[model samples]
Target: MRRTTTGPRDLPPLGVQQAFRLPETADVVLPEGLRVVCLRSPSAPMIELVLRIPFLCATENDGATAEVLATTLLRGALGRGEEDVDTELARAGCSLGAVRRSDRIEISGSGPSAALETLVGVLADVLTGASHAGTEVDRARRRLAERLPLLRARPSTLAAEALRVHCRGDSPALRLIPAEAAVASVTADGVRALHRAAVVPAGAQLVLVGDLDPERTVALLAARLREWRSRRPVGTVVPRAPEHWQRPVRLVDRPGSVQSLIRLVSPAPARTDPRFAALSLANVVFGGSFSSRLLSNVRERGGYAYWAGSRFDDILEAMVIAVNADTATDTTVSAVAEIRAELRSMATKPVTDDELRVAGNYLLGASALAMSSQVGLATAVSTTIGFGLPPQWLESFSDEVRSVTGRQVRELAEEMFASATFTGVVLGDARLLAGPLGEHLDMVLA
Candidate 1:
């Protein structure tokens, strides 16, 4: 056992501090075809690795499969059970995570730089040399399956699920709910096959950020992960244009519910689009933050909802505006109508100079505050790599927000609000004091 003086782990003294921004990532094409994009953050006393791969949920079926894959990741890896792995992480003073979203599969972790070797070794073991016999999978399947009954007991969860089923149509995101069933369907063969197909070499980016020497860190990683191989090609068939893009405005009928939870989603610029900056600024002014238009109208003046704001999903694939509050169900009609009106107003009227200034300031200031911490800085760097952005992209964020004029915001609003361009999703008891909503917006009863 080692005793430390002051540091959290009481590890040996560190050597150096190095600042970095998207340094030329060393492309170590492994013999097994895995791509290693390594960025050494030598300044901090921690090393973080993001084994993010391009796992696309192209179709609903594919998405469902991914859902199963994400949860079961911690269930067992490297012949270890979830309990063993989770406990190991705790003892290491490290955290490991898995996120399977509509767009991609993100697996990331961080730990004291003193344990950089242990961190990378375990990570590579889980990602590449993983297999837990069959006991872990069988145990996880039963545990996850037992939780399905709980969703029915919660009104909010039920209504949200209903809306997703309606709006997503046959998308995998909707199908992958109640994670237990998804786990049960995943056999060891199915799991391994998915890993081979989805989590291969070209899909992997072993992002290393920490206080270790750049050369040494890469050297250590190369030594451990040298034999790890990628089993499949880089990409998958991309999901087609969403069939439910103009899904009927669904009022998920949650009986006896007091407040309405409204969520509207529509297509936004893709991550690869050049207009991302402009759209990002537009989103800020329109509904990106707490002091956004939707908030001003719904909470400030109309006194309808307490929490109302919208944001562009950082992925840039879609823009979703979520608003929730505990008001009478009877007020739902007026509330929904008011939100729609606010959208039109944002599109038509020029944002005030004060509005532009405040929003831009918040955007810029928030960006700076976010990047101030070690974890935040690591996250920013990981985001840059995961979402495909340039090294100097963060520097450009404030400038873009400041340059966004009232004119630009108005233009974006009108462009975004065009008919059928957006779909509305409401989680409430729809049968409460309803007017003719289907005449304008597509309506569905969830």
Candidate 2:
């Protein structure tokens, strides 16, 4: 028999991982100020398109108009009825959608590579001449009004809206859920006016990825969107979660609720910041993953919550990290306390060497998996580009995570994850949880 020792065996050292590289992209700017980025990936014979326009709402009513505009944009355009648009897209085997957010309006499309020109032409027509018909506008308005109550009733939605209100005050851009009256007031004329003012090609980004010639694709877009122009500059800088305007912990009362939704928000470094990688890994160890300390303490050990986690929320040039937990009504305060304890521990102590290595490996692996698909890669590139970072950021992110030291993570955690740095909202039966939570947090009723 082979000799065996009682001493612990040392595992082999990890080998160096290959660097992640995205396909090379060709970029161009149209005379109308539209930026086009195209990459050739032959994984499939289909193309994905993402168009981003800086559409800002000046008030809640403007948000209503934007919502209606997005709904009706693909409904009809250029003398084409809704059915006509659909038929044309179906002929090209294409699918498209338009979404309006507080910061921007996004139009995404996918189709076979052979139909790229036709797909882009349809989108261009919609962009330049969307017919926000009265009937469609009314239908969309009714749908939104009907759905608003259901969405607002969700505890998670309640907590998120409360957090936004507390962090950003009453900024209309951050008002994701509009009031019923606002939705009822949306009209075709209002949507058309908002589209005219906001949906110009100036300062917009269009990313196309698939099995196509990048140069030819750029040329095609430049020619097709030549008329999709306006003198208006981009509007609405994405709203940042203000670090200075934070309020005391808010308790949104939900009578007779069985569970409490807790959300804590704190400022986080933007992706372009050098500290971003360190903070991301630290977050993974702290609460970003299933194996995070927050979950282990608050759920597995204390039995106060079913789930708890954290994530980075993006804004214009900044970011915020949110810690979330849902727990039994009676354990609400205990869960919150455990979350705070994890934060304190992360802030005060250096993560172990093993924790740092695991977090780094997880971060790198997750990034690769997220970008493995053509759609995922396109989205990653477009999002990074939209945030004013070079596409190379995605390529270098793995290396950055690999190089992050335990000390760096600890320092970043200290800088960002302190218990005192957070402002939050708790949605629970205030009659049952208010007294207990108030003692541990600076609590207020909402």
Q: Please provide, for model 1 over 1-446, each residue's C-alpha lDDT reduced to its tens digit, 9 standing for 90 to 100.
A: 99567756655753322222344445455565555555555566787777766665544345545655666676656667778878878888888877675456778888998877777767777667566346655554565566566746665566555545454444444443545445457565665667667766564556666666666677787788776665654344432346556656776666677777776766777645666666666677766787788777777788877566776542123334433443456666666677777777766676777876666666667776676655666677667656666545765655565566677766766786544556656766666633445544667675
Summing lDDT over every window of 10 consecutive residues in candidate 2, give the lowest-scoring window.
232-241
Q: How many residue pairs clash in each candidate?
A: 7, 0
RMSD after Cα superposition, model 2: 3.7
Scored against the true structure, residue 39 in model 2 reaches a CA lDDT of: 88
What TM-score does prediction 2 earn?
A: 0.93
RMSD of each: 8.7, 3.7
lDDT of 1: 0.62
Pairs with backbone N, CA or C atoms under 3 Å apart (clashes), candidate 2: none
